[model samples]
Target chain A: MNSSSISNYINTLFPQFEPALREKLIEQVTIKDFKAGEHLMQTGQYFRSTVLIVEGRVKLYREGTDGNEFFMYYLQPGEACALSMICAAKQESSKIMGKAIEDSTILMVPITLMDDLMKQYPSWYYFVMETYRSRFEELLLVIDSIAFNGLDQRLSFYLQKQQEQLQTNELQLTHQEIASDLNSSREVISRLLKKMEQKGEIKLYRNFIELKK
Target chain B: MNSSSISNYINTLFPQFEPALREKLIEQVTIKDFKAGEHLMQTGQYFRSTVLIVEGRVKLYREGTDGNEFFMYYLQPGEACALSMICAAKQESSKIMGKAIEDSTILMVPITLMDDLMKQYPSWYYFVMETYRSRFEELLLVIDSIAFNGLDQRLSFYLQKQQEQLQTNELQLTHQEIASDLNSSREVISRLLKKMEQKGEIKLYRNFIELKK
Candidate 1:
């Protein structure tokens, strides 16, 4: 996309930005594209720039010390990873992993400009605060699910969230993948899937799960 | 405390604030005192103002639907609740609870000034983002504990954190309180404590736990 197109897209999301400030943002940001199944970021890595997802989806997950992965949330168009912004501001390393689940376009704003943007633009400050607020609330919900909800309920919630992100009831995932995301073993996930299938909640295929209407 | 003393205290924590901004913050913020065991905030309640703890400690906990409380973290004298800031900024209600664990003094900044402060003060904006980032990371750690660590290990980690916060190896809490914080039964916590005591890790008492040297 051209610079004007990028500026227009940003303005659409944050209409409060003035022309001059918007132009400055457009000038400072660089656009990058990632193919499907690409690692946008990894654990223990520092983010040189904060990313704004201009197009497509990004999956964020937390990796445990033993290499177990648990699904955290997704970043859609118009959303940025709050953790990335936080780490960028603090000059710290990320503890979570981010991957593009599909072909994605992201606007990269260098860390050097973040402070200036916040200081100069009220809209940018609001955007940053709102991002942090929403992400903080999301993390709380994730904790609630793991702390209070049963594994089966968490699995169902995970599938529902995934379907919503993918915009389809049919999910292209193996039981093992589901198990890994939920931090459960494949045998346990298979047993739960069998029970779910028996109850007609989902139809399990060789490598996919179809949520019944 | 006097206004100048409060300003001095805030300056100690956030020295980046300009003298003018610091004076503005001091002028706008009202200091409120809380008795030990007072509720600073509760679940599902709206935050009318953001609080900065000027003295003593605050215990932050998440309440489950059934009213079971899980301890999330603590807010020391220098810190503020990031959720309160977020909720205040967005005009949203809080999902967790906060209580003054000891006699405490807090500076309450009205929600009306939040935007103006962000617009006028770079230090305030940085403080807000850093708060959100640290709290977000804390929530992730909570999730890691629940998802990866066993209950016994979580209990141990909990005790260690409590001891660190209280600045005493002798924790002044009942087994029931510990169970409530960990979202387990008193019987379960008692059993685990008994095991830890046998292992010479802690000495259990009627209403307190003493960590061994």
Candidate 2:
């Protein structure tokens, strides 16, 4: 997108920003493109800049010491990673990982400008706070699912969320991929998917699962 | 404590605030006392004001639909509940519950003043952001524990955290209480406690647990 289109898109997403502040943001931000399946971030890596998703989707997950990946959530267009902003602000390293799930465009703002933006723009401060609050709530919900809900329930919920995010009933992921995302073994995920298919909740193929309403 | 002492204490705890802003906070805030076991906040309840803990400890937990309580973390003196601040700013209801773990004194700042404070005081904005960042990280850690760690390891980590927070090796809680906090059955927790005791990791007493290390 051209500079004017980018500015308009950002203004549309965060209309609370003053025109001058919006212009400043447009001037300072550098747009970066990532191909599908590219790593946007990794655990233990320092955040050099905070990102704002201008287009496409990003998958976020937490990595275990043994290289296990547990799916966290996804960031869509107009959404920024709350952890990135916070870690960038505090000069801390990331404990989670992010990847581009599709061809994506992101606006990256340098960490040096964070303090100035907060002081100069009320909209920036509000946007950051809202992002943190929503993400915090999402993390708590994830904990609730793990702590209280059964594995089957969590699997169903996970599938539903995936469908919602992809905007399709068909999910193009293998049972092994699902297992990795949920921190389960391939055999267990396969069994669960078979059970779900038997119950008519989903139809499983070789490498895809279709959710049935 | 007297008003002057309270002011001095708050100033010490949140040294980021400017003198004038601190004076304004002192003028606007009201101190409230809570006995141990008193509910500071409940799920689905609107936060009329945000709290800053001045004395004692507060326990935070998420409650399931069936009333199962999964302990999240604690708010010690000088710490504020980031959720409360965010919910107050957004005028949203709380999804987690907070209770006084001991006789506690808290300074309550009305929700109406949150906007004014954010706009007028850069220190207040920074403090809010820091609070959100730390709490977000804590939630992510909780997710890691539940998703990847074994129950026994989680129990050990939970007890260690309790000991750290209460500053005592001897924790005053029943097996049932611990089970509720961890969202496990009493039998399961009792079994784990017995195993820990057998390993010389802890000594279990009636309604109490003493860490050996």
Candidate 3:
């Protein structure tokens, strides 16, 4: 009875999923929700299920030694958390963290059924591979940004990414927020922002920065 | 005839692989060799097969904008290149670079058989998942080092990693080499090494740094 609602969510959110695989998920999966600003997963926590996002957004980041959040990537609706899948499969603790940037829903597929799904559903296996590949590539890009670029260049890339990901010219982030994400000081980020503003690349407002198109 | 040699190598290096799975690989996979310092995969290059190391070591790193290489992790015998598996499956170009740190032999498994192997062999599927999980975890650790720690701490961690991975107290790398790997200036690294020497952690020499017992 409750599964019917799950089936609806799965069908709408993951239209590309094979019918048989969706049916399998509906039979075995449970729904979980997180409010905005909630921590969905924390460092060193073990997950019992493979998580599939159904609605809203989840932000993934690494927790620094002093608990500062270093932004990594985002999880949108109709996607899976690659770390959850891997950690669940291996029964390992997570080293990173996941938080709900917006109220979000996810399908919790039990780790017990993972091997069976991989064997029985080709689409499921492909999805798993694709998720790993995409997240792996994202990490490589992050490494490249930090390894190759200076603070100014990294700021530029980060803003560009946020602009593209958020789909808006107005980025609702504070100088301190950007500083924490980039593991720099607020003063440094503010100075960089001022430089950008002077260069006509951005316009700073009270609560948001307008990216000049 | 050629397959028998491959079979022997597979058996010796990866005994944990299921017998049937190893047989399938011997029948279908081809062996490729890389001399030390040779590039196996470069930025934007596409791979024809998933690479599994059978002998020696591969160093995986990110290529910076100015072509500086930032070390990520090492791949030793009996392990598969997780990115190779992903890119080969997706028909995508590699974002990271791989080089033979030691003269290496690898088995190249054609992408066409990846699906069949996953479905037919449970152990093979597990290996694939394990490969992805391990590499993903390594990347997270790399992120943590760069994002959270200072240059001195990172260097300490790097030298410790080198000692562990090489199974020796003597590290045969120059300051310039270590600087390139850590994406830092040679002067800074040399100063840090001198500091470490003052503290009796390691002894600086012409071509190598020897750890104090």
Give the per-residue Cα lDDT of candidate 1 at B192: 93
TM-score-based ranking, best first? 3, 2, 1
* Per-candidate TM-score against the hidden true structure: 0.93, 0.95, 0.97
Give the true-structure RMSD of model 1. Answer: 2.2
lDDT of each residue in B10-94, candidate 1, tens digit only:
7886677888888898788888889999998989899989989988899999988888788999998878889889999899999
Which of the predicted structures, 1 or 2, would earn the higher DockQ when compared with the native?
2
Q: What digit string (tens of lDDT, one per residue) describes model 3 on residues A99-206?
A: 998999888999999988888887888888889988998998898888788899899999999998889999999999899889899999999999999999999998
Across residues A1-213, which tens digit of lDDT does each residue of candidate 2 receive? Answer: 668877876788767788888888888888888999998998999998999998889999998777888999999988889988999989999999999989998888889999888778888888887888788888887987899898888899899989999999999999888888899888998888899999999998878898999
The reply for model 1, stretches above 4 Å from the true place, is A1-17, B1-16
lDDT of 3 by residue, B112-186 (tens): 999888899888888888899888889988998988888999999999999989999999999999998999999
Model 1 gets an lDDT of 0.88
Q: iRMS for all predictions?
A: 1.0, 1.1, 0.8
Which sections of candidate 2 miss by over 4 Å? A1-16, B1-8
DockQ for candidate 3? 0.87
RMSD of 3: 1.4
Order of candidate numbers by DockQ, starting with the best: 3, 2, 1
